[model samples]
Target: MSVCKERAWKTLEELSFIRVAGTQEELKAAQYLKNECEKAGINAEIEEFEIDMPVISKATFEVLEPYKKEYHVIGIGKSGTTDENGIETELVYIENAVDVHLNHVKGKICLLHGRLNPELSEKLIKAGAVGTISIAGSFYDEKSIADELRPRNTFGKGGQLPGLVMHISDAEELVRSHPAKVRMVLLQDAEKKGISHNVVATIEGSDLKDEILTLSAHYDSVPYSKGAWDNATGSITVLEMMHYFAKHQPRRTVKAVWCGSEEIGLVGSRKYCETHKDEMDKTIFNINFDMTGVTLGHEICCVSASNDVMHAIEYLAKLENNALECKLDTYSSDSTSFAGAGVPACTFARLAPMGGAQIHNHYDTMEHLDPDSFMITLNFALHFAKQLVNTTTNLIPRKFDEVITKKLEERKKWFSEEKDEKKKESEENKDEKTKEEEKK
Candidate 1:
C-alpha cells in the first residue's frame, strides 16, 4: 500500500529506452505500461491517436560561394521541401530575426540563432525566405555532444519553409567564413501520419465517483535519450500512485494517463482534453509530473490554477515539512492542457541544478537519478492528493486569477490559430479534390 521506491526504480529501468513519439519504441513503452497495470489488477487501455510524423529522407547543407564544403544536418520535419537541386541563395545570419533582420531575408537562406517558434516561423515565411538553417547546441560543447544535433519539426502552419538544423560549432565556422551563397536541400514526406498512444488506467472511487482526479506523466522521450530522468521517473511516479490508490480506495475517482508525444508540443494531453471534453466539468483537478527523481535537485510545483490553490499547496508543503518552491504559473507540460480545459492543474518536478544533469539528449541517463530522491516529490504529492479526494466539498476553486487567465487566453489563441490553419488547409484540399472529380 505504501510507495515502493524499489518497485518504481525497477519500472524505470524497464522503460529505459529511447521512446520517441510516433515511433515503434513509443508504442512498445505504452504496451509495457498497459501490461504492468493489468498485472496489478488495474484495468488499463491504450488509446491510439494519429500524429503528424514527417519522414525526412534527405537533407544537405552546402556552402558554394566562399568555399565548397558540406556540413552534416538534419531536416526539420514537417517543413516544406525543395527541388532535388535544392535552394541556392545568399546565406544571411540573422541574430534573432527581428523586424529589421527579417526585412532583408527575402530571397535568402537565413541562419537563425536560436530555436524556431511559431511566431518566428510565420515571420520568416512572410519575409519570403527560401530556406532556413537553425543552430543547436552550445559553442563550447564537446565534439561528440555537438555532433548530435537534435531533430525538430516545423509548426506545420501554412507555407512552412524548408529548414535544417546544424551544430553550433559548425554554424560558428560557417559564419566566420562569410559564406555568400549556400545550397540547402530538404526532402521530407510532410504529409506522413503516424500513430501514438495514451495509456489510460482508472481506479474508480467507492463514493463520489463522479468527481475525477487525473494524474499524468509523459512516457515519450526525445531522440538519443533513454529519458530516465526526463520522464521515466515521472511515468513510474504516477504508476506507483495508481498502485497506492488500488490498495487504498479513495472517495473520488483517480485516473492515471501515461501521455505520449508530450515532447512534441504536449500533443497527447491536448488530444486527451479535446477527446474527453464532456468530462471536463467533472474533472476536479489534474496533477502532472514531468521530470523527477534527480539525485541533486529541488522540488518545485507549478500551479496553473488560482492563487488560492497555489497557497493551499504551499501550506501543505510547510505542514509536511517538505521543502518545495510552489508558484502560480503555467508549466510547459501536460498540466497546461488540463488547465486549458478549465480543470485546476499543477505540475510537480524535481529539477536538477545547472551543470548537474541535462535532458533531451543521450546524456539523460539514470546516473543522475536516485530512488530516494524520486520518492520525495511523490510522497508529498500523495499526502496533498489524499486531502483533495477525501474532503467532502471540492475546496479548490476552478477559476484562475487575472494573470493566469491572460496567459491561458494567449495559449488558447495559439491553439486556435493552429486549428484555423488546419481547417483552411483541409477545405482547400477538399476543393481541389472536387475540381479533379469534375474534370474526370
Candidate 2:
C-alpha cells in the first residue's frame, strides 16, 4: 500500500480541532474531511443525527457562600437549565450510585467515581439529583470521555437522566470540600433531538463488487478530550489508506468509514451497522483502527473476528513487518460494538495506554505528539487494509470465538460483583464500630 505522508498529515491537521459534543466544530471537521475524501474521488457522506440534548460545552463550578474555587466539569455535562444563583445541595460521595441506593440522593448533589457503571449514572437522575459527576478512572479516560462516554439511550422506552463528568483530581477536591456549601450551575441551553452522522468512502472493486472489506475508524468523539491518538489518527490512517486503494483498486469492495458518535456509547458504529444490515451481512471482513500511536510497552494485539480475520491481519502483519506488536482488546474501541452485535469484527490501536489520555488532555496538541511509532502503526494498518482489499480468496467465516469475548465480559461482571460484596462488608464493619462507640 502506498503511504502518503502529505495527505495523511493534511487530514490530521484538518481534524486536529475541538469538535465537542454536537457542536458546529464537529460538523465543520467532518465536512472538511468529507471534502478531502471527495477530492480523492471517493464518495463520502455525513451520517447526521441529533443529540438527545446537545451537550453544553463550557460549564463552570464555583464554590459560593464561603470560598470560590473553580472546578472544570470533566466532560460534556448534562443539558439542562438551572437557577442562575446555582443549585445548593449537600455534596456526598455515593460510592457506586448504580450499584447502591439512588433515593437517598434526593435534594442533594451526588459525586460518583469507580467507573461509569450504567446502573450508577441513571440512578442519580432517578434519585432526583440536580446534577451528576463521574470521576476519571484507569479506564480509557481519554477516548472514553471524548467519544465513548454517553448516557445510555432510552429512546422509545423509558425515562432519562441528567449528568456530566469530571476528572479524578477535580472530583477529589470537590469531595474533600466536606461541609463545603456551593452553588453548582450547568448551562444546557442548546440541544438537538437525535442527530448523528457517519462518514464513509467507497472504492469500486476491479473484479469483485459483491465482496467487501471495511477499514473503519469512528470519526466522532466525546467532550473534555481531543480524540487525536484515540481516533483522529485512526481517521487519518483511513484517509491515507484511501489514497493507496483508490490508486490501485482491490478485488473486494473496499470501504473506509469514519463513523460518528462512537464515543457516546458506540452510537455511530451501532447505527451504521443497523442501517447497512444488508451490506454488513455481505461484509467479509471489518478491520477497525483506534489508538494506533505505537507506544513503547503496548503490543498491537488483534481482537480478531471469530472467522479468522485475525489470521488475515496476522498474516499481513508478518508479511509487512514482524516488528509489529500484537495485542488483545477485550473491552476497548468501536470493534466491540460490532462484535457485540455478532458481527465479525476486531479492534487495533496503540499498545501503550495512559489510561487513554495522550490525545485526551490539552497536551494532545500535535506539537507534543510522538509520530515515530505512530508511523509504524500507520504503515502496518495500511498494509493490512491493502492485503484484505487485494485478496480474492474468501475468508473462512468461523463463528467469532465467543470464548474470549465471553470471558472478558464475565471478568467485568465478576469484578463488579466482588466489589459490591467487599463494599457491603465494609459497611457492616462501620456499623459495628458505631455500636461499640455508643456502648463505650
lDDT of 1 by residue, 302-328 (tens): 999999999999989999998899999
> Candidate 2 residues 199-244, lDDT tens each?
8788888888788778888766555556666678788877888888
Model 1, which residues run further than 4 Å from truth?
A: 156-159, 433-440
Question: Per-prediction count of colliding residue pairs?
Answer: 0, 29
Q: What lDDT does candidate 1 reach at residue 16?
A: 88
Residue 53 in candidate 2, Cα distance off native in Å: 3.9
Kindly report which residue stretches of model 2 are placed more than 4 angstroms away from their true locations once superposed: 55-87, 96-107, 122-131, 137-164, 180-191, 194-196, 221-227, 294-299, 307-331, 353-357, 368-372, 396-398, 403-440
lDDT of each: 0.90, 0.64
> Cα miss at 5, model 1 (Å)?
1.2
